[model samples]
Target: MEATDCRRAFPSFDEPALKATFDITLVADKELTALSNMDVKEEKILESGKKATSFNTSPVMSTYLVAFIVGELSYVESNYFRVPVRVYATPGMEDRCKFSAELGARTLEFFEKKFDVPYPLPKMDMVGIHDFSAGAMENWGLVTYRVVDLLFDEENDNANTKQRVAEVVQHELAHQWFGNLVTMDWWDGLWLNEGFATWMSWYSCNSFYPDWKVWETYVGDNLQSCLALDSLRSSHPVEVPVKRADEVNQIFDAISYSKGSCIVKMVSIILGEDTFIRGISRYLKRHQYGNTETGDLWKALSEESGLDVAGIMDTWTSKVGFPVLTVSEDGNTIHVRQNRFLATGDVKPEEDTTIYPLSLALRNKSGKVENINLDKREISIDLSKYDASSAFYKLNADQAGLYRTLYPPERVVKLSQAGADNLLSVEDRVGLIADTASLSVSGYQKTSALLDLISLWKNEKEPNVWMEMLKRFGAIRKTWIFQPESTTDALKQLLGELVLPKVNELGWNFHAEESLLQQQLKGTLFSSAVSSENDKIVKEALSLFEKYASGDAKAVHPNIRAAVFGAAAKYGDEATWQRLVDVYTSPKSSVEGLAAITALGGAKNVDLQKKTIKLTLDGTVRSQDVFYVLNGLSTNVAGIQILWDWLREEWDAITKKFPANMGLLLNIIYICTGSLATPQHLKEFDEFFKSKDTKGFDKAVSISRDRLVSRIAWLERDVKDVEEWLAKHQSSTKL
Candidate 1:
């Protein structure tokens, strides 16, 4: 049985007295070993030609913590006292699984040290499942992991993937305390459970692996997914009400995971890090093996830190969306205001009177201040406090707070001029640059400033910071004001001035036997320069691509592939697109190959678009490929007819084979039905939409209303149309 089905098959109460043993028996396929949560009390090769391993009853815990997996399992087994520690995965993935186990051991060790308690469970077995629906699960003593989330071969794993695996394992292990031990009383406190664990996981990873910049990545990259959703009008607070299991799953999104974790980070920042840890330790001790609500956490925190935890968290946890901190300074005083910030083109913001629990940090010529409250909607800090009036001042300093900043155009210019000399964090710098791009600045001037900022980061920052800056600069490079040639030069100049320095300074060498390209890849984008004086950037990237494509090739980094394609599609030869398509269609293609296909299709290259669609016709592509081809095809006239006809002729077969994958197809169908509808095509798509004998129409509508249509709204940037679409689809489009 599937895990959730197992929960339903044996329902039990959450009451303290309700404890019982469960004996589950299922035939295991030959590829895997049968395993469960407790000690191996019984093991027998049955008459049915199956090996059955029965685990003794576990401690009373939440049903969601239960796990079972069948896979080609190799194990690294040990013991912490009587409790066995076993980590298992598919045979080839054992080394990375071992690393993951190491991370878990370290985290468990830390928790044991910090919590002043012994390891509670009698056995801990972590198994990496090939097709897990979520990242990882904390199942009392039996944690299950996604293959990608657990296995990390040191010799083959990229720096970034290794770090991500470590953090994912740490996060799940932490749940043994925050979630599995002291459960949330209801789903409204789900954020507290998830958020606390997410934060602690990163904290633990950072403590173990300092170079990873785990927190920065979590803030800049992952947290944005949550913020993007939360910025929508339909968003709820991190701590949201979930009266049913379906409702509980709905909040298991970026908001509950990343943004909710960010809030915990903010709490750590606001109250000192030690204070937050002390509070959490007190919380776990107070509620050990019991259930707790959001308020229970607040009570423990308040008692431990002697802070007004309730007042602060209540405003943040119950409120929907984040504030816009608009800061301005004169010769005497600095002004800050609390307001909602929708992206510049967003329509119909909520009522303006809602207040955000604003955390303020002021850094003059000196380092950052502890914390100040901008409790009022508009508050001013007197700049007469022993520093120059025009000193570097950053709002939402160090990205500690969860709001967007509204640095006006003049301030952008000033910061651009200041460059890396300013004290803002890399994320804050990214926000500043993005904010500048969104504002009403002259395109050429913005380009120059962006180039300057990019130059500053390349020259002075770490790899992660450099990557963030490259992404920001690359994002706005192709705006309407600059010709592709001009943008290419600017990119070239930015990349050109830096490659040799990086190669020589960082000792990135490529010998015949040990090419740098053979290194396990990291990151998900690539780019290069083509200046007359610095063409090595382009040449090296192309060389790497070619080397990576050779039969004995190293695994090409996802970031490198994205970067190469992005660079090539913009300015590299047209032949580069053909090479990409060739690799994508090849039988040797992996998931990265699919990603390249998606990126190329998303690039809006007409020829590349046709090639992607044609791949599906060969029946060599995955189901997702069909969706990408369809989704990409939706925007164009030539492919739209092909798409419409396919929907008409093969709609039933497609839905029958892949019901869950039909949503994006239907969404594209919906949009095309409205605009490009022929009476015949419209009838077909409409019938397909209405004739859902399966279980995904609401999901289809949700996809359209939440992701697809919202993107179209931004592309169209027509406020009235956005409002009309929202009105028509209010029931289905809750972000």
Candidate 2:
């Protein structure tokens, strides 16, 4: 229904602004149930002994919101909201719908309160579609989700699974108001729908479960994801022009979802939470059952805050990339310079034209935040008045801006020390790590500097900070995937040293009373330790995996089940691989099946890798789940080459299989080619796609190529720097 696909269903003016009321009627077998965007108004027996169900006329809505489904479905209902909320699935999976039904009802109620609007529809029905291409479609009152996103088992699924289901359910529910009620005028304003929904989902989720600390994770997950993509030359503006349907799919990327939400978050921070929500509520009320451009939202926000919101936000949305602020200090005044940032570290003068409205909220030892804006290329600020001692000052406090900060190398060390002394917020620590790592890759700082900085965080307590550090290390590891065996071993040793203590401290046990973050941290540390090939962790993982594979249900905790399977696959023989395949063939739940598929990609043996690849093409794996297997393979050194070769050999058959689903094909292309880091790989990628007509996925291919070029340049520029650092600090512990 999204991105102008409604015309494929029926003939009508399919653009989003062309709103109409739909009278949907379905004729199905008498035993099957029928559903639409509205409640059923009448039912009768058809002449052919089938049932004919006619739904009430829907409210004035876009063509995409019209939906009708006839299937043998069962549902779990909840009375938590004023209107009936139900989660439906196939007959056998009714029990799994209970969690989503309850969560969905609560989320709808939360949105209704926050938006200052009641649920406009009579009933809210969410269904699990077996072969869904996207995560979920917010089709007016009838939302459709992939089975995995809407169904959950509290006992069998891990903490990550629970969080994912909650976020997805909440995200789609949010669109009920943002997308369905107040629609976007055209495809260019798609972010107006997606970005607001993404931001609202996190806001409501945090309110519902504050202990989860979803905001902390947002820095590492959402902020960093968008920054990575937006740094590329192939990236587009947030409000990109989309004249055709083919161009729309490419904009449904990190820039629109992650970067777009980041812009919303930055504005909220500037305006204060209460004021921001008030403005959003006002916008929704004024535009209910109507279409809007991006300016409509800005006008409402500006009126509420008494500021030129449009002036502050237009460049951010209309521009293609963000800026990096380089900070230097002299006596008391600190000079800050802003320039367009690119991952390749080679921004030409022509490309550095955008003067973004930056939020330079400076913080120091006194815990006072100065709200300063830098609209020019450079600015100087005197901090002596704020902090006489000049202990430590950080720009872009809490990383609220859509820009990165580059401190002097010595200042970076001081920030690390400050973090160790508990003087920085979790967001500050994460931003420091993210910025330093990115700077190192782009040659703004030496790779050794980043190595030294992360080496000091072994005792860091926060899970989010550790997660950010691990991701940086992972990027370095991937860039140097083709390095000498000794170099790779040294990198793994460093990783093992950083994570082993945490692994031992947390142990491999779960308790109901432990916080969700604690459970997630334990799992992350254990998996990382195992990946580093530590003897003790690998031995323990195999032992648990052996017992679990032999039908002992309690041998491994659900929290670390994937890690155990991955360890066994990475280090075991053919027998272990076969055991994992059997588990994939017949699993207790969909979660277990996905875990097995992902673990199969970690198999180091060539024959095992081939076997796993074969399973993806055969009927054994669902087409919708093929990306899981390919993504797993992309992480393995041996499997990376194997996956690219397979993708090349099977491109035609793959395209034929997924001709209609551009999003899935785009994911497959990324999984197959995104990890390639060598110049030779880039040449080969270009040669292969040069002749192919990549009309639907041209942007994906361009991004992949651009990423490879950046990786190759980074490696060529910093190989000696990384190698020397690793050699000097190489651990005696063997991988």
Candidate 3:
């Protein structure tokens, strides 16, 4: 029901701005129930022995949000809010809806209070659709979710699964006001709906559970992803032009969802949070049940903040890429310059022309923040007043801006030391690691420099900081997959040294009284340890997996179950693989099934890898869930070549399985070919696609090509540098 798919359901003016009120009526079997965007008004038994249900007239909404369902559905209801909030699933799964039902009710109440608006509808219903596409759809009051994203078994599911469900429920509920009440005028303004929902969901989730520290995760998860995709030359503007229906699916990427939210976050930091919320509340109240363009939102914000909101934000939305702020210092002044950043590290003169309005919220050792703006290409500020000699200052403090900050090498070292001393916020530490990693990839700095900077963070405690570090290490390892075995072993040894201590400290047990962050941290450390082939962790994981596979459900903790299964697949024989398949076939919960499917790709045996790939097309995997298997294979060095070869051999069959227009075809293309880094790999990729029509996913191909080129350049530029660093440090690395 997103991106103008509403026309496929019925004939009408299907544009977003052309909203209409709908009166829905359904005739179904007497035992089934019917639901719509509104509450039911009447139900009657027909003479033909069926039931007819009529709903109240819905408020003005886009056609895409118009939904109806007639099924033998069972629901769990909550009266904790202004109206009834219900979570529905098949009859046998009613108990699984209790968590979502309570969370959804509380989220609705939280949003109503924040936005200063009431829930206009009489009831809210969230249903789990087994074959649904997308994570979840915000279909007015009747939201539809993929069952895996909605249902949860608190005792059996991991901490990550709980976090995902909470965020998805809160994200869809946010659309009730941001997307449904105030619609986007056209497809080009889709970010207005998606970006705001993403930002609002995090905002509300943080409020409901501050202990989750969602904002820290946002720096690593949302901010870095957008920055990565936007660094490519093939990337489009956040407000990209969509000339055809097929082009709309291509723009539903990291730019619109992640970068768009990052922009909103930047604006909120500039204007105080309270003022930002006030301005958005005014905007929503003014445009209730109406359509809007991007400018309308800025105008409302300008009226509240008394600034040229559009002047500061227009270029950010219209431009294709973001800027990199290069910082240097003189005796008493600090100099900063902005330029367009590219992953290939080769920005032509024409590509480096845009100047972004930057917010340099500089902070010093005293915890005082200085709000400074650089609207031009370069600027100089006096730092003597802040005692710059005695204290270190960080720009883009807390990473509230959309641009990357490149400090001098010495400053990077100082910041890393500050992070180690616990003098910086979690967001600041994440941004420091992210910035250095990116700068290294783009050639603004050397790979050795990034390695040196992160080496100082061996004592880091925050999960998000470690997550960023591990991601950077993973990128390096993947790009060097074809190097000598000795080189890859050295990198693995380095990873073991960096992560094993944390793994041993956290151990492989889940405590009921632990904070959510600690639980997530423990899982991350164990997974990294297993991947690095740490002998102790691998031995422990195998023992636990053996017991778990032998019918002891509690042998392995839910937090580390996925890692244990992966170790079993990677090190065990055919019998272990068969047990994993059995678990996948009959899982206790949806998350457990997915964990098994993802682990299947970790099989080190070539025959087992082939078997996993065959499962994708042998009717064992649902069409919607094929990506999980392919994505897992893409990450496995043992399975990467196998998956690529399978793609080349089965191109037509794979395309037929996932049509180009469904938006999933892009995911298939990425998972199949995105990891290739060598020049010969690029040639093969280009040669294979020479005769195929890439009309719908042409952008995907271009982005993949761009990434491959970047990886090739990085490997060529830093291969010897990384090898030497590892050689020098390998003697001191501990297991």
Local accuracy of candidate 3 as per-residue lDDT tens digits, 502-619: 8888787888999888998888889999999988899999999878887899898888888998899888788988888778778888878778888888888878888999988888
Candidate achieving higher lDDT, 1 or 2: 2
Clashes of each: 6, 0, 0
Question: Which window of 10 residues has the lowest lDDT sum in candidate 3?
Answer: 383-392
Clashing pairs in 3: none
In lDDT terms, which candidate is top? Answer: 2
Off by over 4 Å in 3: 732-735
Q: What is the C-alpha lDDT of each candidate?
A: 0.58, 0.88, 0.87
Supply candidate 1's per-residue lDDT for 277.
Answer: 81
**Which residue pairs clash in candidate 1?**
96-152, 523-559, 524-559, 525-559, 525-563, 526-563
Please give the distance, in angstroms, between residue 344's alpha carbon in candidate 1 and its true position after superposition. 4.8
> Alpha carbon lDDT of residue 437, candidate 2?
88
Q: Give the alpha carbon lDDT tens digit for every residue of 96-184 in model 2.
A: 89999999999989888988999899999999997788898899889999888889987778888888889989999999989899999
Across 680-730, the per-residue lDDT of candidate 1 in tens digits comes to 443454466566553434433433334333333333332233234334433
Could you give me the TM-score of model 3 versus the true structure?
Answer: 0.97
